[model samples]
Target: MDLDLAQVRAFVLAAEESHFGRAAEALSISQQALSKRIARLEAGLGTALFRRTGHGVEPTGAGDRFLEPARRALAAADRAVAAALDERRPPRVDVWGHLYAPMRTLAQVAAGSGAPPLELGHGRDLPSVAAALLRGDIDAAFGRVHPPLPAGLTHRLVRLEPVDAVLSADHPLADEPALRPGQLRDSVLWTPAALHRLDFLHRFAERFGIRHHAEGTNLGLDGFLADVAADPRRFSLMPADVPLPDDPGIRSVPLVEPTPLYAWSLLWCGGNPRVDALLGALAAEAGRSRWLEYDPAEDWLPEPAGEPA
Candidate 1:
């Protein structure tokens, strides 16, 4: 049966007021119109919803049963209208990343602006995070640089970092002030997905042709270090400034030959609310920091040049 909000309101008001004139007045409709609406509602429901009385109207059993459902329907309609109104403009987007220095910088940049609140997604690496972005699950990702970016995505490199090879402190190479790929040839490797820097590993492999055996396909932070501790010959290459436990048995050495570097970047699909606001915030911070877009050959600093003194 068909019934409108107006009919439901008429039913409610008429039931509450008991007097046709007062109910019609409260509903801003003529008494005749109110009565007709109630009659139409009763006919549609095929139930006598109210009993007329000398004092006021009272709901019949059916009317009492329908009251809560009607109220719920009305409330749901109200929420739908509000949500639609809020979505009248562009759709809000979600931004995601690991809480690292560069990402923290991006967050600060985005947060500093008084724009729509940036919704942040938590993840450890770029690919999984970027996968979500590409699947339309997220609007933007701020983590390790995304490569071979899918169509319809734009990636902008905000910063670049030289890398260091992490090894057990007791290892012989760790004692060397600084070493290169050749020196690490026989070392077993323990790279984590969260490390998210593929190019560096490839470059190291290309230069020295080191097997760099992986202890486990995917290992957590503690597991990774534990595996390395178990075998002192294992080493992992990671970003230069990222903090690691100061374990006496672990060491991080600067790799020299295929000295690797990775870009810090922001990636997004066009025209999403989250993407626009986040990109704007990132751009603003980039401006204030005088941060230049990364250009591998030209922008990358030599081994120690850009590293902290």
Candidate 2:
């Protein structure tokens, strides 16, 4: 028998909440509508699924038996929708955080190498990019990653970048040649939530007692720097490789102390012959480049998990 997914989801929620009012609120529907949906579902299955109690509603014996299966069905429906959406999208490589390095690699590869040209675009932060790669929303991406990737992904080392700070041009420290990690003990720093939430950022800030404001601010990159320029009380860190905007009001300063390096990687899904060739060519180029410091001899590089469908 064909089952209605919405009704099944409603049934599961009502059973779990054990109160029609609470269940409807959770589902963002009225209690009367929730009652009707449950009633329709119960009638379809020829059972009395709930009993009105003094305090609320209690699931019947049959309702208890059906709840687990209903939840499973709802989950299966969600997966089906996601899969269908992925299939409809075109293939592209997504840049999770910074686009400069990865774009440079791909551009060089497209120029001299016989590898297929790649279309690149911006993807979200770490975990979100991870999800999109697995879901087939993008064929590959570049971002900072440490250690083993997800079950269906692999990474190639790009470069290890030094920690640097961004400060307003008018700030007292802007004219300094370089920065040390501990010089900001009583200072205020601002970084987007995504960047500052990294374990490395948290640990480094805590050691020096640096007060950080991680607002994931609405101000775009230029606006963010402009705000920093207006307020000498703020500062933020970046990897030496991260491209800095040429705003006269702001400056990029390298943090000479070398503990928390930004490890960038080229992340990809498995088994596209063209993409695999492209990755091989790109890796070869990186190994030869002076700035990248890649080593083809390193046994640490992991292969793609398995062929992408």
Candidate 3:
């Protein structure tokens, strides 16, 4: 026999309310419709389920016996529907650039807290990265956002680190405390051939109206440094985090004017659960750090459990 949840619900309500009219009203259905559903239910089980009395209604022996199981089955059906609705919103996996450091720390925290390790993806440039995000190709992205990012994407600046200008010791600007974008004009500039190059050079050039030359066809770190030292006039820029070369002939000066600071941010589409989770984790880490240094007494008030304190 195939039992229906609607029939089970009707039977429970009728049994609980003990009145066909009140049960149907509680269920927001016509009493005749409720009676028909109950009749169908009883027919499926091959038993008479209720006796209609003048005062109200009484459950037959078969109906009384089936009551508990019927209620359980209806509850299970409701839970199944709820679960289906919840599954309509699935969590997403995160994707980040190779240079993302703080998120790597957060990923470690999530792992320690039993979250699965993050997944990563790569693209040649920021526009390409932003495109992938717009197309739903990745759940979240991590990298620098020099200006306000693309309109739809949201970001949180997690960390900032200094980048230094690399030069041969004899280079004219090597000793300068900071560099203005204009000073590098007519100089051979070297940078990674990756997206970061375009982000720093092209964008900076456009923003500050500086003319510069890109060194070599493809000058990577090793080649750029080699080129810089070989030709004392040529200089390359890299993050200050790079270990200083043993060659006292080379020096790294922290650049000022356009402030050579690199920003690391977590970004995602405006509304997404995976991104939300990632942000929440990041915020928790920040809060933990902040609470340690400057504790806020008002924020940690004791909760009232049994009696008010």
Top-lDDT candidate index: 2
Task: Please provide, for model 3 over 168-249, each residue's C-alpha lDDT reduced to its tens digit, 9 standing for 90 to 100.
Answer: 7778887887776567665666544543455655554555444554545453455556666766666666665665557767
Candidate 1 is scored at a TM of 0.55
By TM-score, rank the candidates, best first. 2, 1, 3
Badly placed stretches (over 4 Å) of model 2 are: 1-91, 98-112, 146-149, 194-200, 207-209, 214-218, 241-243, 291-309
- The CA lDDT at 246 in model 3 is 76
| Number of the top TM-score candidate | 2
lDDT of 2 by residue, 210-247 (tens): 86554446356676667777767667766566667777
Error of 3 at 301 (Å): 40
Worst 10 residues of 2 by lDDT: 299-308
Worst 10 residues of 1 by lDDT: 300-309
Q: Considering lDDT, which of the candidate structures 1 and 3 is the better prediction for this target? A: 1
**Residues 132-166, model 1: lDDT tens digits:** 55435555666555345544556666555667878
Query: Against the unseen true structure, what C-alpha lDDT does each candidate score?
Result: 0.62, 0.64, 0.61
Residue 261 in model 3: lDDT: 46
User: Who is ahead in lDDT, 1 or 2?
Assistant: 2
- Candidate 2: how many backbone clashes? 1
Where model 1 places Cα greater than 4 Å from the true spot, the runs are 1-116, 122-131, 145-147, 193-200, 217-219, 284-309
